[model samples]
Target: MEGIAIKLNKNISLSLLALIFFLIGLFSIYTEVFSGIDRMILDYKFRHLQQEDSNKKIVLVSIDEKSLSYFNSNGMYWPWPREFYQIVTDYFHESGAELIVYDILFDTPDFDRRNLSGTMSDRRFLQSLKRSNNAILAFKSTENEDPAVDLSMNNEPLIEHYNIKNDPPYKEPHLLTSKPLDKFAKAATGLGNTVMSPDEDGLIRSIHLFDSLAYKGFVPTLSMAAFLELQPDTVSLEWTSSGLRIGDQNIPLQDNGDYLINWYEKGGVRNGTFPYYSFQAIVKSAIQKMRNPDAEVSVPPSVLEDKIIIVGASAAGLGDIKSTPISSLEPFPGMEIQATILNNLIGNNFITQPPTWIAILILLLISIGIPFVIAYSRPGKGAAAIISILFAIIGIGLALFTYERIWFSTGLYLIMATIAYSGSAAYKYFAEEKQKKEIRSAFGQYVQPEFVEQLIAQPNLLKLGGQKKRLTVLFSDIAGFTSISEEKAPEELVSFLNEYLGTMTDIIFKHSGTVDKYIGDAVMAFWGAPIDQDNHAELACRSTLKMMQKVKELAPQDTNIHSRFGIATGDMIVGNIGSYNRFNYTVLGDTVNLAARLEAANKKFGSNTMIAEKTYEDVKDVFYGRQLDFLVVKGKTKPVRVYELMGEKSDPDTEELEKIISTYQKGLDFYLNREWDKAMNRFQEVLSLKPEDGPSETYIERCKKFKEEPPPKDWDGVFHLKTK
Candidate 1:
């Protein structure tokens, strides 16, 4: 029955610990501390996953450092004459390219304003766009102002198809606030916004399809505008519960009407993953071709056949660099990002985020499951369980990403599982330590310090039964405690007692003595039971002498305080001895009773410390002591030999102290032999040697009493105490 109760308690404590860990895990997940970590893990997965091929139909013409250097060498800086773009566009149109998309905006007139030869460069650029008929010009929008265009010239098909007034996909949005000349805007195929919205982590992972115009409904993004140009007729715009529909294609839009761009390839690699042509090289080739029909070009004109050209800067000085998961420190060009978006639209490799409900459910499962598994498993097994869960979670995430292009938040689950498992382990460790602390608090004073630690390690050692062993016991009390207590008030008396007892207890513990109990001002202690000590007798005697010395140091100015000690060594049963609910560890036998009586006997002997003959024998070689006399203590039948413990043999004043002891021993010898005058003279001589000596003065009075009224001739040397 007792065993069953213990097991039940153990289970209950484990359950409580598991619950605490689960709650903490839940809080961490709820606060989205794992969100950023999850995103980072996704980035890693994206980098390691199988690389996708770049769109064959798309090509990037970068205005890179090589192009900048080439142009600068020709005495021309950037924002080159619009004639450059005009010539490039004309060449692409002539090369059978389906579309020419300019990521750069021609929002203002040329600064030179000087028409060369027949026409201004802006008019020539506009004429080139009209000739291609498939050119898509990029523009930007601002919420502050509308573009200075003829708002009456409507793409009526866009407005009439879906007349949803003031909707997010159609209302007061980033209006096209900048534009080329009105004649140029009117002649272009279509104007699209080139604003790419990056996620909070500064990676352009997606693009909004269009930006709303306050006056003209909405304007499509560059990719969307190009797609529209491919359609022969105006496509209908339909909004359903799922997403927006253009023509027969259903476009899945996020909550904010943005498309998640599926990046096709990594950046910052040899040859990258996309075909790139230097803009200056292409322009120079085109100009040379226009001048001389058979000029050699850096790139073959056939490469642009049926391809969509993207014109944007890739030079670091141009500041078009953007952060992507593929290259963090080294920025990916914005032109490449747009090319990816365009390719994503064509390939339909858009990534879809799972609903919030699924994320919450996964969080709940991990938070509860991890802690429970770890808390229930055996210590080492818990770590294995955590590993298994971690692998399973990551595997599931990778499977989803690989097979379905779905990105699951595996990082959060892994972190939550790890934290919950670790928290459970920490909780168990601290809980065990707390139990050990309680054990130490309960029995620290009653058992030797070493035994207290042992009890913490092996609690079964604490029980009711004890074994009989030869041990040393000590008892100490203030010699005149009654008189001292009578002089002080209750508060002052408690303060005084605590200070003295606290100091004495520290000394006892330092010497490895078990303080058995404190009875009023008296302290009972023992050694060699809880923790075995071969020199328990010596330790007890040494502690008593130190206590006497410490009391002298703490002596009051108005009155002196002294401590009396009695120590003995004998066979005694030591362990818990009392009622079951209120038991204490102590020694019991004649040895303990004799020690107690010896402590009281100090009142009659005028000695600070006393020890049994057995204790004296054990420490006789290491200590300096004086043989006092034999005493038949109260409740003890046999007369036990006693000694007055002075100090160790290494004491500085031992030589002088031994001389006084010799004189006192002589007086004791004469008194025991019933020599009245001789004993009195010897004690007087000892007193003359040390006039303030208590033992010598005491023996002097005893000799006087014996001389006045001598005992019978058969009187033994044993002294009897009338009071205990």
Candidate 2:
């Protein structure tokens, strides 16, 4: 009962520890205690795992170093005249481009009094914007209110038509507004905010689709503006707590109303993720077309047709570079970030983070499940299981991101599992050490040192309960102990018995046997208990042989002191037996009784050691012995075949013993067949070979008595012993 209570308490303690870890994980997740590490893991997944290909419909037009150099040589410096944009817009409008989005801000009108061509340049750019209804211009929005800027300038007539309806009136505060100059905003098809918000880590992982301005209402991002313009008709926009739904497409959003951007590999310039073309290349193509109608252009019509082109500056000096999840060492361009957002919106390939409940549930499972598994398992096996589960979680997260575009919180799960394992392992180590100390204190003097160690390593073996096991039990007693005790004085006899018993006990322990007890002149021991031994029968047999040899060496030259052994192998109950206050680690069953009876029967056969049939069968290959008789003891009804154990097969006199055993078996066979004369002849031959062969001499007398009596007709050959 006490052991059961201890076991239950241990399990409860492990569960409580697991619960503590689970609560810690839950707190960490909700509080974002390890968000930085979580983000790093997310970035690692994006960088290494398989990525989705960039949308081909989106194209990038970079005003790179080459274009800047070409224009500078031609006397056109930075912020080139608006006529340059007019030329590119006219080329794209004539080439059948679907949408042309400029990520550049044009908040002020060109007014160069010295050139006198600035007004003309502005007029030409305005005319191109009105001509190409697909063009969208960029503007800026800020949280800081600017008193110098007229706030009423946000109420432009052209920006009002793209108002997205919010049924519930999104209560999130809107930012202060800025817009392109009135003439340019009125001439362009639409205007969008170009402001980008990066994460706390300074990486642009998400973008706001719509910014609710202070008074101008909701303003769409540059990407969202182009997307809205591509719609076949004016669609209703509904905003809920989840996200905005435009027409039939549902866009998932974070709590702050930002859509997570699924990044693509960093493929730069032409022949990369998205097809790239230089500003000089587009301008040169337009010039070539104006010069000759049949001239081959740099960017063919087919490449630009039906494509959404994003025109933005990419020169290093422009300071448009931003860090992104996929951009590790390389500086990602702001133009490419805009292009990526637009691509995600167009394709509906945004990465969605599942609900907080899902992450919490995963964290809870890992924290609780890992400790429970580790608590019941061996140390080495438990460590292996923990490592395997961690990898499986990572693989599952990566697989979901790669194929489903779903982001699972795997980093938190790993942290929770690691904590659970660490706590469980430390507890197990200390608990085992405590168990070892208790085992040494309790069983040190009772059992051998090695047996105590075995119990310590596997403490469950010390439970106060019996379990049925196939075991080999040994009973050894001194032959004629009453007479030997009568001959020696009390003090001398005590010393002699202690020496004999101690030697025999040492031999039993050496063979990994547990000494059940020591009766005055007898020793009870067993194998296959406290520790499992598959070769229990062989071990018991070997111990008995060594004990017999040691007795001869320990006895004085004048005195005859011989030890006889009996061994039986069968199912027996082995465990602690008796009241709670006092108990003995021992085995009890019919097998044990048979072994004790065999020890007493050894005196009848005049043999040093005897073993039951089952024991002989188990060690037949290693031991050399001969069958004695199918004798039923006084209290037993059923008969059991017994064998007198001889030396091992490796003994020097094994050949001579084999010949004697062969003769003895033949004599017994004749006796069982009722051939009295032939049985006497075979027994006499065995006795001649071995002068003191006990079973042979006894069998010869039995044959003689049977010949004189001419026993009953239905008589079987089984012999019954009258004494134990």
Best by TM-score: 2
TM-scores for candidates 1 onward, in order: 0.55, 0.71
Mark the regions of model 1 whose C-alpha exceeds 4 Å error after superposition. Answer: 1-33, 113-119, 143-172, 175-177, 199-201, 231-258, 268-270, 288-296, 328-330, 430-724
By summed lDDT, the worst window of 10 consecutive residues in model 1 runs over 157-166
Model 2, global lDDT: 0.82
Worst 10 residues of 2 by lDDT: 167-176
lDDT of 1 by residue, 1-724 (tens): 3334445676676666656655665666567667678778777776777457545888889899998999789777777888888889999998889888888878778656334522478878888999998888777666635456455323333322233333445344554456655666677777677777677888766677766664656667778777767665656766654466666777666555667666655763245666889987788778888888787788667898899888888899998888877775345888787777777667666676676567767766766666566655667797888888889988989888877778766777777677777777786678668868966876786655777888787655544455688999999988778888898899999998898888888888888888888889889888776767899998888888788888888767677678888888899987666654555677899888888888888878788788999989999999988888788888766888899988898778678878878888888899898987888888888778877677777777877888888887889978877789
lDDT of 2 at 677: 90
How far is each candidate from the true structure, as Cα RMSD in Å? 12.4, 6.9
- Candidate 1 has a TM-score of 0.55
For model 1, which pairs clash?
none
